[model samples]
Target: MKGLILAAGRGSRLLPISATRPKHTLPVGGVPIIMRAVQALREAGIDDIGIVTSASSEAALRDVTLGSGHLTFIRQAEALGTGDATLCARTFLEGQPTLLYLGDNLFGDSLRPVMDALDGADAVIGVKRVPNPQAYGVAVVEGGLLRRLVEKPRTPESDLAACGVFAFQPRVLDDVADLPPSTRGEIEFPEALTAILARGGRVRALEFTGFWSDAGTPRDLLDTNAYFLAELRPRVQGQVVNSQVTGTVVVEPGAVVENCTLTGPVWIGPHARVSGSAVGPFVSIGAHSHVSGASIRDSLVDAFTRVQSPERALSRAVVGRHALIGPPGEEGLQLVVGDRSVVRL
Candidate 1:
């Protein structure tokens, strides 16, 4: 089987940060969101991976997946729906079974169930029982089969929201060709599944109860980072001087934390420095980033960023790569901020 991840959508909800960077480009526990999904697909023994990305995000996506060989990148020329993104990989798919995983979807555990379920069903969808199914694409199951599927229904018929991971046979490509634009003006993928049912094709549903995040918004990005960081093993390979590093924290080589008290479930990337700061519980400090004299928790500081705030309490903050969060200078001051960056006092 092959693996295809759809990452063509413009994450409008995660604006300011995602304005330039794709939502899946955001890091979760030092690993980019798309990289984590790719890793999961690799662990499932599906190495021939095809990523469906927008023309704009193709470069950023490729930069993160350098070492991952056997990857085929297909750029969707337009901002199409998930259905179009998946169909764009038809040449690479070649009628073989393909596991379709949404780029932003994250799971706390392994994706072994996806491969196992595809053996019996013509199509297998990953479903999650959520509190508010109206906000998600939900699957209405009858017996063991998916009877119906709805995306963001006003009154959901079921609480089993489709978690954006599915195992699809080559028949879905035919279904896609048979599809027309929905009322919302996009070639919705759910329409393809509906076509499958109309053709008497069997589609089963697999329920997953693990930690999941679509990472559609900035808040979701922060929470998902914290969730993944909690699973890391404790290892401090860096310099910790006059710092109390407790719990399951990973201080990678070349990182230095001095005169700080760090709590568990955190990861400090290589060459990162945190001095005279209070950071903890759920945080990830990216490579070469510096955080000093600040109180940060449940936040992610990306690579090459510098944050210096003596009494600022930063929680649930996502500092993007190469950002500067310190005070501005006057004599020879220079500010080189990226496009669509956010700056707030």
Candidate 2:
């Protein structure tokens, strides 16, 4: 089966953090979000991958995902919905079974089982139990099979939110192409799956119990970063001078952590410098970024960003690349600054 990733979404929920860069290019644990989806598909033995991207984000997405695999980039002309995005890549699929994964969603579960389930079924949807099913496309399972797929239902019949991964047969593409726009005026993937069920096609619902996040907001980015960081093995490839690093932390080559207290489950990217700071317990400093005299926790600092906030505590912040963040006032700063932006509080 081939793999198709939908990375063309504008990431409106991510807001200013996604203002300059594609949300899929944003890093979680020093790796781009789209790269993680690529890895997941690769691990499932799908080498021929196709990434559907918008014209504006194609360059950025290509830069981060270059040489990742046998990847083909298909540009979606308009900001269509997920089903429309998949239909745009029909030529790449070439009538073969395709595994469609949303680029922004991150799940810790393996796709091997989902692929295996597709052996007997026409489609298999990866689902996770979420609190707010109204905000997501949900699956209704009856007798261990997916009975219906609903998008943002007012009264959700099931808590199983469709978690952005689906194994579809070759004929599913025709069904997607035939689907009309939903009430929201977009051709949603859920409607496509429901159409498959209506045609007597079997669709299995595979529930994922592991960590899963859409990563479409600053808070979700921090939470997803922390989840991935928690699985990080302790490795120090950089220089640590007068620093106390506890727990699991990965200091990549060329990164220097000096006079800092890293409280575990942290990732310091290559060439990043952290000095005189208290970082960690879920933090990822991007490559070539510099953070000095700052007390940061549960934050993601993008590459090439300069944060010089002495005696200030920054938490739950997502700082973009090439930006400058100054020291904050008494209340401290929890910001979502975009690329090349300056925040001097």
Candidate 3:
């Protein structure tokens, strides 16, 4: 089996943060989100992978995913839909059963079961019960068999939403290629699955009740960061001078944490500098960022960002790369600053 990751979404919902880089290139627990997906695919024993990316994100995605595997990058001319994105990689699929993972969906569960489930099945759709089923592709299952797939139905039949991961047989590519634009005017993957079901294709529903996030918005990013950080193992490869570091903290090499109080589940990326700060409890400071005289918690400061002298604490903040936040703030700040932005509070 092969792996196909569709990373071509424009990520407009994550704007400003995604202004400079694709959200897939953004870090979660000091690793790029796309790379995490790659790891999951690799763990399933699939080495040959095809990544479909947009024109704007292709270069950046290549930079982060370099040397990861036998990766073939395909460019989707437009940000159509997941089905269109998959169609862009038809050459890579090459008549092999494929594992299709949405680039932005972050699933913390094992994917080997999904791989194992492809036996004698035309497709396996991963489904999880979500409160907002109408917002996602809804899966209607009866007797553990997928009866139909609907793309954001007006009235959802079930709470089981398609979780953006699927195992497809070799002929599924032909099915996806023959798909037409949905009412949303884009080629949707769910519509193709629904078509497959209409033709009596063997489709099974796999229920996943673990942590899964599309990571499409700021809140999703922070939540995904914290969820992954909870599994962190303490490894201090950098200088921790005169600091009170506790819990599951990882200070990467070339980083310096001086005179700071770092609580658990905090990640200080390589070459990041933190001084006179109280960082922790689910915070990820990106590579080469500098945080000084600030108290930050439950936030993500992207690579090359600077947080200086914020009198009040920062919580639930998602600052993008090369951002300059501060001088000081009168009260606690909750920000969603974009890349290369300068915010003086």
Candidate 4:
């Protein structure tokens, strides 16, 4: 069995942050989403893995997966649909069963259950019962088999939402080649699977009840960061001075915290400095970042970011890498930030 990760998407929704790097490179809990996806596959005992990347991300993807001796990179020529991206790995797949994991998605549970259920199945898609099914690819299941797959159906027929994790047989490539373009003019992977379903292929379903995030937008990314951060084991290796740190927080080496209050499920990357601030409760401060005179919670401050907003509390925010977001000079400034709104100040 082989593991294939689709990481070629441009990630337009996650702009500014993803503008310089590939979507798959976005970090959650200080680990790249693509890397975590690869780790998940490895944990499931599928060591032979191939990553589908675009030209823009090919080099970085290789660099990120370098230490993994068994990982291979497959370049996708165009920004086609998921089907096209997976199709690029056809040669590498070589008729072996493959697990197609979406790059942006982070699943809390292991894929071993799905792999175990693929003993004689044509395909098995990981599904979760979500409150809002309209935003996901809804799967219609009957008698433990996939009846049909709908792409964001207006009125969802079932609560089973496709979590972008799929196991496909060798014949899946033929179906992908024969698929018609979706409304967006790209060969949709689901449409390709429709052909396989019509031919009586035995596609099964595996239900996942734990946390899952498809970090498409900024808010989604922030939420995912918090979710995964909470699951991490707490550790502190940095220099703490007159600071109060509590509960499941990871402070890597070279980090310095002075006169600050930090509450965990949080991650402070290496070389980061937090002074005269309160950071905590599901927050991630990237490498080399400086947080001074600020109160941040449930937020993600990217690498090299400098945030010094002591007056106004920062919550549910995403500060892009190298960004300088803070209150204006001369003080006495009042700002009202809206929820889910992006601000450059």
Better of 1 and 4 by lDDT: 4
Displacement of residue 275 (Cα, Å) in model 3 is 0.5
Tens-digit per-residue lDDT, 1-345, candidate 2: 899999998887777777877999999988999999999999888899999999999999999988775689999998878888988998889999888899998888888888888988889999999999999887899876999887789999999999989998898888898999877688887677788888999999999999999998777888899889888889999999999988999999999999999998899999999998999889899999999989998888889989896556888878888977775556866576445444545
Angstrom error at residue 129, model 2: 1.1
TM-score, candidate 4, is 0.94
Clash pairs detected, candidate 4: none
Better by lDDT, candidate 3 or 2:
3
- Per-model lDDT: 0.85, 0.88, 0.89, 0.86
Q: All candidates' TM-scores?
A: 0.93, 0.93, 0.94, 0.94
In model 1, the runs with Cα more than 4 Å from the true position are 327-345
| lDDT value, residue 16 of candidate 2 | 73
Off by over 4 Å in 2: 328-345
Residue-level lDDT tens digits of model 4 in 100-215 = 89888989899998888888888888899999999889999987788899989899999889998988888888989988878788877767666878998888889999998899
Estimate, for each residue in 48-165, the C-alpha lDDT of model 1 and write its tens digit: 8999998889999999888877689999888768787887889999999988998999998678788888886778888989999999988999987899898899999989999989
Clashing pairs in 2: none
Stretches off by above 4 angstroms in model 4 are 331-341
lDDT leader: 3
Q: What is the C-alpha RMSD of each candidate to the true structure, in Å?
A: 2.7, 2.9, 2.9, 2.7
- Report the C-alpha displacement of residue 253, candidate 3, in angstroms: 0.4
